[model samples]
Target: MVAARITVNGKETPISPAAPHTTVLDFLRERGLTGTKEGCAEGECGACSILVARPGVNKPTDWVAVNACLVPVAALDGQEVVTSEGLATAGEPGKPSTLHPVQEEMAVRGGSQCGYCTPGFVCSMAAEYYRPDRCAHADADGHTDAEHGPNGFDLHALSGNLCRCTGYRPIRDAAFAVGTPTEEDPLARRREQAPPAPAATEYTQDDSAFVRKSTLEETLRLLRERPDAVVVAGS
Candidate 1:
């Protein structure tokens, strides 16, 4: 079997060949990161959603919402990826030992009922907030969508995350109430940001290689060829 190196969360992990058809979800779970769920192994559901970072900076990296289940395992090599386990530490710099503003907001506003989909939504929101090129433009809010932009505090972040228990009202309020917490958590001031819009999905300066595969055989063939591939699999 071929081998490869991958940077998950903030650590480097070495992976093995999967006979060509392993999903990123399986890889992550096997590696002990159960945060990347696998409700629907297909691209239709965002359960297996995780963050994959291609090197980029002030010029944000191109962040594409990809299906981990659909993406072959050999496509990820030398890539910087973030899973739910790493979001608290790797999210938008400046905050340490704290949950990402998005996730924290969801908790505060009662946005998390089942909490199964919270991680996916948080990562997705972080991508939206950090993508430099994906500007929301000056809507009713004076400036473009700031991390604390006016429209930035909306329930749409929950769209990627599913909620079967609590209705969307609390989730919406949570997304809208971020970074503006009450006396309960005073430090929230520095953490809050605005809601992200559509164009805000793709980050600038981000580089990622997208490899499409239909079956495990093709994926294994690719892995055998590119031992250093970065594969994101399903659980």
Candidate 2:
């Protein structure tokens, strides 16, 4: 079984005796973090969207949205993950927590209906909100133009998330309503202080092994060592 420690929502979680193929959705739900739902398990629905930050690389900011149902828990070793539950800022004693700007816009704009898909949408939108290219456009009123294509907000970001009960109008409104993030935003601070990307690591569970090589030389060496191993690419 794969055993490793990973950071979740800024806290370290020790995964002991976990199956190598255990999905991230299953692992999170088993820990009572049900905010990330399992919709199509095949990774097409985007209902299990979550933000993942690795040790290295910084193209689309530090974190990127991913489908939890299609990701193996072992793949998150030494990485950081943020679910819908982590979107809100912590509240003071006896005070209510403050929702992220994306969550607040979604609620105020009636973007959520049945709430089953809200979490996934929130996570995906949060990633887009933190994108570096998000500040390219904004009206003087500080709102994105929904009528225009490729404005400050990209509606295509939500293409993966599906909502059966609600229309896309309100959701699009919420997307446009998210103004340019201020320096006070938690994610903005994270982006400002993100660490460099991490090198690839290998993990093993029973007879199964998962390896992520940092360099082509290392990958070739491993392949030469295990010539009989099955090689599969892309989740």
Candidate 3:
């Protein structure tokens, strides 16, 4: 059986055929990319969050934060995924990589405590930091008033994430402190030139299979043929 190849953190990773049911969280951990943690496998905790690039109407690509534990490894084929480890700018071999704005802000503002939920929070916050409408709510002074600015940072973006030790105030502070990102930021460049979404593809190994349908017809056909198959949806 051929290994299922997928891109992770700018490199192509070949997944073994024996684990068709592997979750994205497991896939990353297996490769030692432990930055993405799993606090709850049910997708309620948001502790396994990671950024994913998907097709968009207004833009070439849209960045979204999703629970890695809830996503299947096969579903990642031909898709671009960025884990917490991939958020920072790559540095020279002997130098340390520069931290992403979200990471820097989180650290400067004391957003982490036990650190179990820090990785997930950082990924989710990074998604919001890169959002095109992030500054929509800023006032004339270029600052968003705490819980008052209309169109400002959406605190609800962190609704899916849970941080039992740090509480919400510090995290909220980090979110507001993210300020404007510089042009040199990798994510800033990605926002301007994200690649288009990949076409649907099917992955099969032994008796197990995973299918990503690009069109309604193909999706309907799959549902009709496999009525009892489990379906997962992402928002």
In terms of TM-score, the best-performing candidate is 3
lDDT of every model, 2 decimals: 0.56, 0.80, 0.79
- Each candidate structure's TM-score, on Cα atoms with residue i matched to residue i, is 0.61, 0.84, 0.85
Better model by TM-score: candidate 2 vs candidate 3: 3
lDDT of 1: 0.56
**Candidates 1 and 2, the one with greater lDDT:** 2
**Tens digit of per-residue lDDT, candidate 1, span 131-160:** 444333356647643333444543343356
**Per-residue lDDT of candidate 3, residues 1-235 (tens digit):** 3355777887887766537678999999888999888787989988899988865445566678889998788877767789989988889999999888889989988999889899999988877777776656766777766662344567777888999884778898888767776777666567666664554757777787777788889898999999987776662
Instruction: Rate residue 189 of model 3 by lDDT.
Output: 69
Q: After superposition, how far is residue 227 of candidate 3 from its true place, in Å?
A: 4.7
Off by over 4 Å in 3: 1-3, 136-151, 222-228, 233-235
Candidate 3, lDDT over the whole model: 0.79
Q: Which of 1 and 3 is the better model by TM-score?
A: 3
- Candidate achieving higher TM-score, 1 or 2: 2
